[model samples]
Each structure stands twice: as structure tokens, then as C-alpha cells.
Target: MSFEFIEVADMSTEADYEPKNIFLTGGAGFIGSHAAILLAKKYPHYNVVVYDKLDYCACIENLNEVMDLPNFKFVKGDICSSDLVTYVFKENKIDTVLHFAAQTHVDNSFGNSFAFTQSNIYGTHVLLECAKNCPTMRRFVHVSTDEVYGEGEDFDAKPMDEEHVLEPTNPYAATKAGAEFLVKSYHRSFKLPVIITRGNNVYGPHQFPEKLIPKFANQILRGLPVTIHGDGSNTRNFLFVEDVARAFDCILHKGEVGKIYNIGGCNELPNIEVAKSLIKILGKEKEMDDYITYVPDRKFNDLRYTITSEKLHKLGWKEEMSWEDGLRKTVEWYKTYTNRYGNIENALVAHPRMTGTSPTNI
Candidate 1:
């Protein structure tokens, strides 16, 4: 299955930037998989080399859609392994590095904070060091999270633009902020063409059930109680995975180097609202009282996270997926792809970190 590549004029530099061979780290995980499939299908001419360590929550099956594509290739390796990262860069002739690999779950970060630092901070360092040596490297887009901005008490308050200060409250978010500083340094000191993106919570089909949305959906599917932290008033801005994939595509083609873009979503729903939506979508709305169970909230759960995407909007990319439409699609996708993760018993647990579930939400 091939797709027509849309050519958007590169406005970031005087010289036009073209993406040919892309080295996509963490290409098998949720958002990464969506981006990988999009790049591989949309730009048939672009070679997508997907490298992943296949962490516990990251399933290899997620990349099955693009496995047979001639332009797509997968390499099982750790980004922290400097030797392996360098070899992949040289062998694939990778011109662009989409750094998507990281330990990304907040719940697990509290218990396993060291792993987050190693992968989010040290792994990013390894990629920057390797990309610096590659003459062909043109772009290094680091994927950051909105959580780095910490809590936003007022839902109607001024949105956090790229210039907003990063006040991460959790170990997971702190590590991502630390990694962003490194990315900034490499661009300033070494002059490596780089861009940064900080996006809101993403909900979609391939997501491991460790997250709030998928976790609730999975628990409901098994006729188990849908657990909520605290009273479930904590809110998150959500973007459909497909929408985020396109946002990255826009940044890849037309985004300015050495700049940060906040990929904001219009849908800002609280946790309980999300749970209720999923239950309704799955035809279990009548049983909401039984399925909805409240659990102790995380040690430092942020009340809200908000960001403005005016910069990305100027890039001709606004989210096309509406909340109702996107949520229904996500629930439907989860229904069909439930078995994608063989035995999601651990991921379905309310507190994966306490139960030895090793997922860093990315």
C-alpha cells in the first residue's frame, strides 16, 4: 500500500529540507507506531528505519502493519547502546532522527525513576552524540510531553505556549525536561538542526492499557472494575494519535529548526469524563456504577495541563478529529485490537508500578 507524498515547501531555512531516510527511535510503541506507519505509507520514497528496544509495554505486533513494506525496516536495539546507535545511523544512512523512544508512564516513574533518567536523558544524549557525527543528518526532532509544564490549576487560564516555563512535578516529567535541555544544548553548541515538540496525552488503538483511557477500556472489556485515581477530576488535553502523527509530519517538512512547537488539542476532558465516555462507547453505560471504582491517586498527580498550538496551526495543521468522533474510534479500535497485547493482566492493573509493571508513558 503506497501513498502520494504531499509536498509542503520547507520554510525553516533558506535551503529546502527534504526527508529521505529516517531513523525513528521507539517506532514500535503507540504514538511512534502511528508515526512510523504514516511516514512509511505516505512517503513511499522515504526509507523508515524503525529501531526499538521492545520494552514491556511496547509490543512488536504494533508494527505488523508496516513490516512487509519494502521501505520499512525494524531493528531491535537499545538507544543507550552507543555502539549500536552509531552503527544503525551509518548503516541506514539516516538523514533525520525522530527520537521517540523513552520510558513514558508516570505511574511507573515513581517506583522506577532511574530507568526513566537512563532512557529519557541518557538515551537522548546517545542519539545526539551519534547524530552530530553523521554528515547527512539534517533534522533531529525530539518528542517531549505537555506534562513537563506541570499543573495548570485553571482550566480557563492562559494556555502554555512554547515559551512557558517547564515545571515538571513528577519524576517522569522531570526526566523529559532534562532531556529537552540536552537537545537544546546540542543545537546551540554543535549546530545540529533540531526541533522539539511537546504534545498532550494521546489516545488511540495501539496504546498499552497502562494509560488511563486504554486502561479503563481494557478493564471494562474484561468485566472488571474501571479504576480511577482520586475522584477522577484530574484533566488532560488529548489528541488523537492520527492527528498527532500528521502534526509530526508537518513539523518534519515545514517546522523551523532550533524551535519548539506545542502540539495542543482542543479536547480537554477530565479523567472521570474520559472513563464515562469509554464506558458509554463500549455499550456499558448502564453498568457505569459497577465498573467505575475509585483508587488512591498518584503521589503527585497534576490537576491539569494546557498548551497553545498557534505555531503549529500556522504550519497548516489543526486537529481534524473531534472529541466525540476520536473517542468512539479509539474505543472501537481497542475492541478489535484487545488481544494485540497477549495477556494484558499486568498493564490492566490500577497501579502498574506497584505491581511490577514496567511502562514509562511516552
Candidate 2:
């Protein structure tokens, strides 16, 4: 919940200028864990240190496979704690910061605006300050979402690109957009080597069950109905988790400083269709309608989101997982996970770390 920066040896000056010691926040969460694992395995010489708050959405089991690795480390703390953030960078001599920490759930953000602002906006400012002071810092990759661009497709307009104006429609998107401005300001005023990324809807394994895919997947397994927002016609692009991880890696190493890149998947579909597809995957196609319940739309739901990843593509990045394949893999992962714990709510409520019954990962 909180961390204090004690007298750890100040090794910031001795850090290598490259990404030797990488500091990644939110690394225990869905996208962060995937990126952490990828970086840990792909660059064994670099110390992949994950700093996270271990929120309800964060699961230590997500990093079980990489927990014992020589170069992998995890610190438990909130990013809002500037002292803790600064200590992590100075103590670890962290040169590269992959910022993935934030309040990501859109619906939750509506009611918990303070949490989003504190974590997403102020938390980013804390990290940027620490990063700007680090002599060995190379890249500050600020991971963002396409929702910052507001609604995507218009009557005849094409997908939004990097140059599109930022008009975030919801509290969560507003906080993220505000964070992006902070990153850009740090780059402009302090000359921090920063690059920002805006990606469309991301879905895959290890994701907390709060999101649509995993939530609905478990609901279907329990023979319960899935909740559909509004008319469920709102559209979004879904990128696989691994693909987003690779995109982050490419941006960290190859992307231009002070640039913003859009990472988007090719697949675009309606929300109801996505739920129906999941039902079909579960062999409950005949019960699709029976298994879906219409709910009130989000307070400020975006009808659609479309962002082009042309800039990232130019950096030699390409999506290797098709939506169909990606969705299948995601559904299977949830199936295996549900089988192990019987349900996500039970697993989260019972997890020692999440329940605050034990010390979080070191």
C-alpha cells in the first residue's frame, strides 16, 4: 500500500546508459506481465525489475513462470509514492522505464475518478520526475490507450492517426490523456527521452476478469448471462497481449524520442458480436441470446475507436496473431484458469497477496 525510500546505496551515477536495468511499473498486471516476461527472456543481461502496487487486478501468479529468473525482480508499492519510485530508479540504477501502471477500467473510472487521477496522472508525474533526474535514463516509454483520441470512426472518415486531436470522452481516458501531456511536457521542458504509445482494445491471457473477454468467458462457463452495455453495437479493435508486448519492446528500442505511436489490431467488431463469438467458442451458440443480458450503456461510452499503427509498422512491427486465433487462445486460457479456481472472484478474494493477508512480492 505504501513504501518508504530508506538509505539504499545511490547507484544512479554508475548505471549503464543503455537499458541494462529496466524499471517497469504495473508489471504484475495483464499487459505489464507479458512485456516483463518478454523483456526478461529476450534480454537476459538486462535486469527486468517490476514495480507494482499489487492491486486487486494484479496477480503474482501471472509472473510465476519468470519468478525464479536471475534477471527478474518485483517490488510492491504504489507509483503515487514518489519516494518509492525515485528509490527504485536510484537503487536499481534503472535506465529504462516502461510505465504501464494506471487505473485501466473505464467503467470503474466513472465512479472512482479520484483513483484514476491519482494513479494515472499524478503517478506518471512522479515517475517522470524520477526518470528526469536519473543520469543513466535512456527511454521513458509511456503506454497509453487509443481512447485518448475520443470516438474513432466518423460517417466517412478513416481511422484516427497519431496527429489526431486528443479528446478523451471518459474519466479514464481523460486521465490517460492528461498523463500523455505530462510525458510530453517532461520531454519538452526537461528533455526526458520519452515516447508514448496509444493502442486500441487489448485482450489476451492473464488479464484480470474485469474486462469483457475474461468476464464473459467465465460467465459463460458458469452458465450465466453476459452483460452487454447499451445496444452492444459499440465497436473496438482488439490486439493480442503478446503483440502489444512486442510493440512496446520495439518502441522502447527503435521508436523516436518525443514521438507518439499508435498500435492497433486489424480486427474490428461490435461488442455484442464479440460476446456472441465467445459463446460460439464455448459451444453454446444455440444459447447465445439466452446467455446475454442488456445493461445500461456506460455514462460516456465511445461508439467506436480506430487508430492506425502505420508509424509502428514502419518500425518493422507486424501483428502475428489474428483476432480469431487470439480470441481462441484467450478463451482457452480463461477456461484453464476457471477450472483451476472455479471462478475469478473466488480466486481474487482468496489470493493471499491481493487480500493483503501476506507480504506482496519482493
Candidate 3:
């Protein structure tokens, strides 16, 4: 199926809105980098401008492959800066916006709630304000997380749907939920064309080594034990990064405006189980005792997160890579990169104290 948006004067239908200049936020990060590359290559006619603040966990190396693409360009700026956001939006005549910038780590949010609020909530509002005034803007794709639903009892009974109430357990999720409300409000109050996507945990190459899959994989490669919060039973649905980009592309082209869609991966596993599986994948089963460490639980750890993507699936979007396959690919990439580079410190966007513990929005 074609995921290209059609150009029109009225912009009444999805096919009528063809974006020539795409403003992509957070393109230096993992998922953003992937999406930017796909859009630049797939839609060569569109100018893809990547605007990012290069936060602690954002690595410029992630975009190394597509940096030279004729259609691709990068701008170093913060989304919270109205002046910068406004300048880029007006200067580029950005008609399409894929917002993926935010302070995403739940753990860090506890100590740095202000940062999350500033970046995720305030930053999103800045974008909305700028986009609302942009005459050429057609689509605003706001990427959110499934964690907004929290781990309430209802989650155990059923996967979260689009209508699920926002019950974020941590500061990071709360900020994201707040951002969603802002985006929705803009659509309602200003008639801004926007689509929101809440995706499950995303794992693949180019991910900062702070998340579960990459964190454990890197630790294993360094001959260090993988640290697990609490008993490691907290579960989450893991989706491949490529599938996430596909979902974004589909939503950008086919998703109804002012609506929300859940992008889910069917693969779900407990944290401990995930650790064991990774040990096996790395052929470190014999060193399991030495390679796995159970730590104190997070102050406010959610038991699990589940979401249904029936809405997105109906739009011809489904995960192409299984969890095992994706995990293997991720492991192989980290192993080779580590062997060649010697330390992940080189790829880090900031000091280890920050990037290593910072929770990513994915």
C-alpha cells in the first residue's frame, strides 16, 4: 500500500495533503533517526529537516548513515524554544511535523520531574503553538507512549484501547499524557490537523544503551551482569523500530485527523524472562549466575503495560519482525559495534551518569 499523502487545495481528505517539507523532531534519537531515513529515501521529493536538541540520550551517530542524503538536513535546536521552532517552521514552510522529542526516562523523571515537564509538556505546547499558526502545515504526528494508561487493574483485564483513560504512574508518562491533551486541545480549539500514536516498547539498533534490551545487551558484551529492577517480572510488549516507523508512515497517510491509534507488538515478556532469553541469545547461559543481578525495585514501577493495535492493524500496519528475530539482530549489532568501538561511551550523547540511566520515551 502507498503511504504517500496526496496534495490538495482544501486538505479535506488524507490524499489531499501532500507535504513537501517535513519537520521531524528528535531525529537524532533512535526511532526518530529510523523514521527520518525511511521518509528521506522513500519520499525523495520531500525535504526532511531533522530538528533536535541533542539531549543526553540522543546520539548523532544514529543518523550517520543518512546524513549525506540530498533530501536530508539536520538542525540543532530545542523544541521548547518558540523562536527556534517558529523560525524552522516558517523558514522551511514545514507542512508535515513528526514530533518525537521529549524527556522519556521514567527513572530519571523521579529526580528530574522538572526536566520532563519542561521538555515533554512545555516543548510539545511550543510546537503546537507554532504549528497552529503555520499556514502551510498539513499534518502534526505526535508520538506518545502506552505507559500513559499506567498499570491499573483494568490493564490486567484488557489491553488499553484508544478510549482508555490517561492514568500515568510516573512523571515521564504524566508529561506525555499532558502533551497528548495539548495536542488534542489544539485540534479541537484551533482545528489543527493532528494524529496521535501511542506505541508499545520499541527495541532495535541505534537505541541508546539506557533501555532494557540495549542496556542488558551492552552489559553482557562488557562482561558485566545485567541489572534488573526488583524481580524483573514487570512486563511490556516489545515492537521493532522498523515496524514503528511503518506505523508512523501509515498513520501519517491514512489515520483520521484528531484521532488516537495504538501501535502494539504482540510480543510480551517479563523482565526476568527477557534477561534470561538475552543471556541465551548471547550464549552466556553458562555465566548466567555471574551475568545477571537483581536490584531493588524502582520507587514506582508499574507491573505491566498492554495495548491493542486493532485500529492500526486495520490500516494495513502489522509487525514484520518477531521479538526473537529483532532481539537477535539487536544483539548482533551491539556485539559487533562494541568489538569495533571498544566502549559505548563514544556513542553516548552525554556523560554515562546521565545517558546510561536516563529512561527513553520508547
Best by TM-score: 1
Q: How accurate locally is residue 55 in candidate 3, as Cα lDDT from 0 to 100?
A: 67
Model 1 lDDT, residue 284, Cα: 88
Clashing pairs in 1: 104-360, 104-361, 104-362, 105-360, 105-361
After superposition, which runs of candidate 3 have C-alpha atoms over 4 Å from their true positions? 1-12, 15-17, 152-156, 339-362
Candidate 3, residue 265: CA error in Å?
Answer: 0.8
Lowest summed lDDT over 10 consecutive residues: which window, candidate 2? Answer: 350-359
Task: Estimate, for each residue in 14-55, the C-alpha lDDT of model 1 and write its tens digit.
Answer: 343579999998888889999999999999999999998877
Candidate 3 has what TM-score? 0.91
TM-scores, all candidates, are: 0.94, 0.89, 0.91
Off by over 4 Å in 2: 1-18, 153-155, 339-362
> Cα lDDT of all candidates, in order?
0.86, 0.80, 0.81
Error of 3 at 166 (Å): 0.8
lDDT of 3 by residue, 1-362 (tens): 21222223244454534679999998988899899888988989989999887766677777887899999899988887899889998888899999988777666777668778888888899999999999988889999999998884534478878888889988989999999888888877788888889989999887878678888888787777888888887888899999999888888877877678899988988898888999999999998889888887777888888888999999889899988899999999887664432355433311123443222323
State model 2's lDDT: 0.80
Compared to the true structure, candidate 1 yields what TM-score? 0.94
